[model samples]
Target chain A: MGSSSAPWKQLLLSSIEANSHLKHHSYFQLATVSSNNRPSNRTVVFRGFQDDGDKILINTDTRTRKINDLKHCPFTEICWYFMESWEQFRISGVVDVIDGTTPDPLKLEQREKSWFASSLRSRVQYVGASPGLPAVASEQSSQSPSLDPSIGPVAAFCLLLFDPHQVDYLNLKSNERLVFTSIASDSGKKLWTSQKVNP
Target chain B: MGSSSAPWKQLLLSSIEANSHLKHHSYFQLATVSSNNRPSNRTVVFRGFQDDGDKILINTDTRTRKINDLKHCPFTEICWYFMESWEQFRISGVVDVIDGTTPDPLKLEQREKSWFASSLRSRVQYVGASPGLPAVASEQSSQSPSLDPSIGPVAAFCLLLFDPHQVDYLNLKSNERLVFTSIASDSGKKLWTSQKVNP
Candidate 1:
């Protein structure tokens, strides 16, 4: 089965697997366009893949600059760098927000837990509260009340998903460099096109 | 007289130099938009920087896929990864072809040499030429065409100059992450706006 696959497909699968395996350790720099046409990029944790690899998911507090940028402009691009190998992978796609719901309760739970853990610090950082303040400190002492009924509903935030239709892969070897591109149609079939450029 | 500067200005100057220096290495990635409204990104060499310190130049041949994408769209984003320190810098701006007769000779020379020196191996790799040839000779013969003229110009052969308006810096530490943004105006004034975000 593996041998039957095209070279581009094989390379893509390997690269994606390598990237996803390094999800926890990888820092993804995501760029989103604002309504004013300016682009904004930030470092985000790679939450995981979804829709059978058709979509990539990331978790972030809804209050962050990225979320605001996404709201203004749904088009975004993401870059993942593997320093050890001097390899880089870039994904550009449309951003769609998804709330926790049916068809994947376990996935929803996992995402929620991750969000909670990640947001514990965000709550303090955004409000200018001292890091020394306890998580359960008084509402005034804390940036915002964690248990605020009014904010809780809006707080269960998740960056729905961004699906890349085009991806570029670059590998820098000691003396040679390789570049390839994969473009997928809406039906999910991918057309692989590649060229080597002067490095 | 231009040597001494205030602490803040000095810091800015040093950062710009450091950032430009990092791009001189073997690999870097740039994000551009496609006609289909999707984002396209690929790795390109860090050709060099301009004397103004306001723009960065990258080399590309006329036959590359990215050039085709750019012909359809000019808005682009770029991400630079510093291998040793795990530091990343991202910029979003408009990409324009630099005219050879522009006022700055230093910038022109740097870019010209970058394009002129792109390897023959890179050209073969860019065109997907290796796969069509026999396996045995492909590996060995790939190195023999270091001087072929066909390797010089790909579709993406023009020099890409990024006129940046904003830059985001991310530094990963053992326990904490630092994130900040700096914006430059037309008047050559740069203002830094920072925020400590949760890792």
Candidate 2:
């Protein structure tokens, strides 16, 4: 319950680094609500961070159903469980979409550099039809648009710029449990104010 | 891509069974949208099934925010990732809360049996203050209501009776990823209409 004293962001970054060093191959479960109000979740790999590490960056194809979900409702949440430390981090907030049509030069530059640096296999996902589309009957990721070396990043490649208003960090790494919330302050400076929460 | 031939229900049951035999600590990430339309998620153990394996069952304390979220929206979603098999299942639907106020005699009986069958350590969670409430500054799961043996089933224990209308099952264990959608028909017979979809 003394989670307030701990630097929440620093702890989170260290947890991620530790998990990666342990070869956890971990992923976060990203949740979004549909226009009809139903909740949907899927696994997403952590790509990077933005906005002074206040925003999380995740890649997706523009044509996916999740992209549509975000369009309808910007409020989303992500949950990450650190296997090595038995810790869990939950972030809830809104997102800004960065795509080919994005106006910001800095974001556009980041996208270009990241795209060129990614492996060709990873870029294949951006080559074909959007994720939720009709597929021909066959074996092997029939609808993954296929892995073709000739494929390059298409206009569908986009990034989700998550702006978190609340962060719930829970650690059960010991006999005791610690739960805390880092919320955006009313000060409007986007500073995170951390407090102890009941575990 | 040949997911069309296999019966939807059969495949799901087999996948669950396979995970159990493989000693996979498989859990589902349950998501519920708050009144403000923000989606939140946490991990829940795959407890059991109701409605003859159609409706999924999960246990929780009445004081959790998720219960309030369900009361506000009723619509929820769960994502289960099978580690060894590299398969994922997403279920989205409404939920029926089973507690002292439930009208169904069968469900009440099920809750009583499940509670008594659970271990003392598990039952201790039901003894605590509402999940979001402040806790006494102390050690060991502070407001986890304490680990006193005298604690019994308080008014907090409840069952989440999930009525899934959409089931999206994907298998990435092999080179080919199989994506299938099983939607409940409008005929009211609970018949699942299955189809192959783009992965």
Candidate 3:
């Protein structure tokens, strides 16, 4: 099976299950490129891991500049550094943006689920000007700023699926560094090719 | 002077001087782009501000991938997020790499100064694998790792000068977000054009 063959995948799975370092700090630094090739990065909350650790989940406001950047330049590197363990995972992947207004029922469910998970204050941010607009002193909206999930940007909070191309797991605590690239088996099942890389 | 007209520059200067929230947390997240436009990011320790806040400094190994990336794509956006104050500063700029091997006395002085400030363990990192090299179990080195200012990658430890193009300051505590752009003044003096950007 895909799960058994990949040692790197198992390591990531165990870390997620342990949840010591990753639970409290789900915010990973997300990097994206502008049209002119300038690198822009900011913090993004990790939603969850998908496909037995084959893919990762993150949500974004459809109006945010990063979502726009992803459309133009789809490749991104999301890095999560664990302070306690001193481990850093550099996951390089291409993204699939599940548009908020999509007619597909499966993606629609994801948007609704993401909205419910988001805090009232976070939901309020998406309904406002698309993220990077020039600031106004205080954006006064009579929209009541309700905590109700239905009242937020139910249509603007999009789902971004990060499908990994490669994962570089570095144990700064130790001298071991591993790189894993996803490949396929003879039977056409997806698997990983793991190797110890120079850190 | 360029410093007087720019309140944003003053704000950054004061923050650095006050050193409350930013003191121990000087590691700002650095984002860079590859030739193929894939965005990669990592955390970089802020060395200091230069040119009256027009430029900032950070030191890194010349053999690292980031320095290589900068050589091809000079534009970079550095982000410093103050967790305690709920303030974020996004600094976008080009880089000027001061090679450690420079014979110039002024450039050599910076390398020497930076070396003195670096910890013994940090100096060890420069001598190992040039960073990002595929790991070979435990890297065995017979040469004793020393804290001497002349030792390690003094030749490989490059000073990266980030010359600002623009700076976007956002206060999550308040709704105020401002973007400042660099411009030349009437007398060929470099100044900034401050604006109230939408947040």
The candidate scoring highest on lDDT is 3
User: Per-residue lDDT of A58-83 in model 1, one digit per residue for the tens?
Assistant: 76655556666677777777776664
Stretch of 10 with least lDDT, candidate 2 chain A: A175-184
**Per-model TM values vs. the true structure:** 0.61, 0.85, 0.84
- Candidate with top TM-score is 2
Per residue, candidate 3 scores C-alpha lDDT tens digits across A10-59 of: 66655555545433356668889976667887777777765455677887
Candidate 3, residues B61-179, lDDT tens digits: the string is 88888877898898888877665565678888888788766678776776666666777777766666646666555554445355555564456778888888788887766667788
lDDT of model 1 at position A106: 66
| Chain A TM-score of candidate 1 vs. true chain A | 0.61
lDDT tens per residue, model 2, A65-166: 888899999989888877667777887878887789989999887777667756776787687544545555552335555565544446878878887777
Of the pair 1 and 3, which is ahead by lDDT? 3
How well does candidate 3 score on lDDT at residue B2? 33
lDDT of 1 by residue, B1-199 (tens): 2322212233334545655544334455677655655455556666545554656677665545666667676767677655445555666667766434446776566555655666655544444433222234355456544445643344334577776655554454332333334556587565555444433
Candidate 2 Cα errors over 4 Å, as ranges: A1-6, A21-24, A138-152, A175-188, B1-6, B17-24, B138-152, B175-187
The DockQ-derived docking category for candidate 3 is medium
CA error at residue B105 for candidate 3, angstroms: 4.9
**Candidate 3 TM-score over all chains jointly:** 0.84
The candidate with the higher DockQ, 1 or 3, is: 3
When candidate 3 is compared with the true two-chain complex, its DockQ is: 0.54
- lDDT against the true structure, per candidate, is 0.54, 0.71, 0.72
